[model samples]
Target: MSDPRTPRPTRNEAPQWQSEDGSLILAKCEDCGEPHYYPRVICPFCSSDNLSWITCSGRGRIYSVSVFRRAEPPYALAYVTLDEGIKMMTNIVDCDLDAIRIDDPVAVVFKDRNGIPTPMFAPVQG
Candidate 1:
């Protein structure tokens, strides 16, 4: 189910990071040999236009997190440090909000928001 309040992604948005099927698309800089999120044409580190799109491992650890228990349905937001060395802001879902902690292992999951596949994370199941 999609949330009505969630904003729809614009077609003009550059570097579309997530595919409709829910795969994560990441941009890597061949020049600096670094990977970054919020996929951009130019590398943030080396300022090079040599970027390539690649499928990411979609695995990361929570670097920082905050749980908004006061919200109507509650939600957790965090910066996840991905295995590819990129940190992205995303929501943590499908688990107990109170159990979320920094450094917890997580994996990517997608939730449909207005027909767009939005990337989120959840605690890696054992």
Candidate 2:
């Protein structure tokens, strides 16, 4: 069972979705006009193969949240529904762990992951 919270292995053949600048590229369903997180060959909603890759605004509202205190560096994880209407599993950083809550506005930021830049969300300032 693969964890949805973890990014897929960086494959040379993987779809060019995430960029080094922190903005996320996602698939937009041509049929239903719904944007989805986590790159895929087909739309999960309508089962349509017609999808377009586009950069999201990288801002979203926290739909849910969880805090893990056992790790070396405790962290907050969440399901954020991007302004584009896609919910993605991501870690929340740069803010106090106890301060994050559902409906908190967040912005995406790039963090180092295995020497590669990965997208992580943080509480939006002001």
Candidate 3:
């Protein structure tokens, strides 16, 4: 387990995938062709030690959402399934909670979260 004082490493923390623009990165299993949300040294599905990182297309569909009405900005949390087949927990911003719907197309956007470049999603434009 990681210490609570230590911050979780983001995609930018790795030497290779330095997503300066806060793009989403997923771990791909070289052995099983499975993709996972968090960076890992081994493929969880196949138990293979070989894994590679790939930048997501920044496109996805909203699987579900939960809105927090008490938040200052009325935070809406979402489970988004990237086109790469990996699902991630992220925030839906720049729109009203009522505007979000299941399977809605979204694009990744970078936002500063407590000094970290966190990824958020917004409705895709035509």
Best by TM-score: 1
Compose the digit string of candidate 2's lDDT tens values, residues 1-126: 643444554442144434766667777889998877676777889999898877879898999999999976788878999888888888999999988889989998878665456778999855
- Candidate 2's displacement at residue 10, Å, is 5.5
Query: Which residue pairs in model 3 clash with each other?
Result: none
Model 2 scores what on Cα lDDT? 0.79
The top-ranked prediction according to lDDT is: 1
Model 1 lowest lDDT segment of ten: 9-18
Error of 2 at 4 (Å): 14
Task: Give candidate 2 misplaced runs (Cα > 4 Å).
Answer: 1-6, 10-17
The Cα RMSD of model 2 versus the native structure comes to 3.7
> lDDT (0-100) at residue 42 of candidate 2?
79
Off by over 4 Å in 3: 1-7, 10-18
Candidate 1 achieves a global lDDT of 0.81
Q: Per-residue lDDT for 1-126 in model 3, tens only?
A: 543432356443352234686677777888898878666676779899788777779899999999999966588899999888778888899997888898999998877654556678998855
RMSD of 3: 4.1
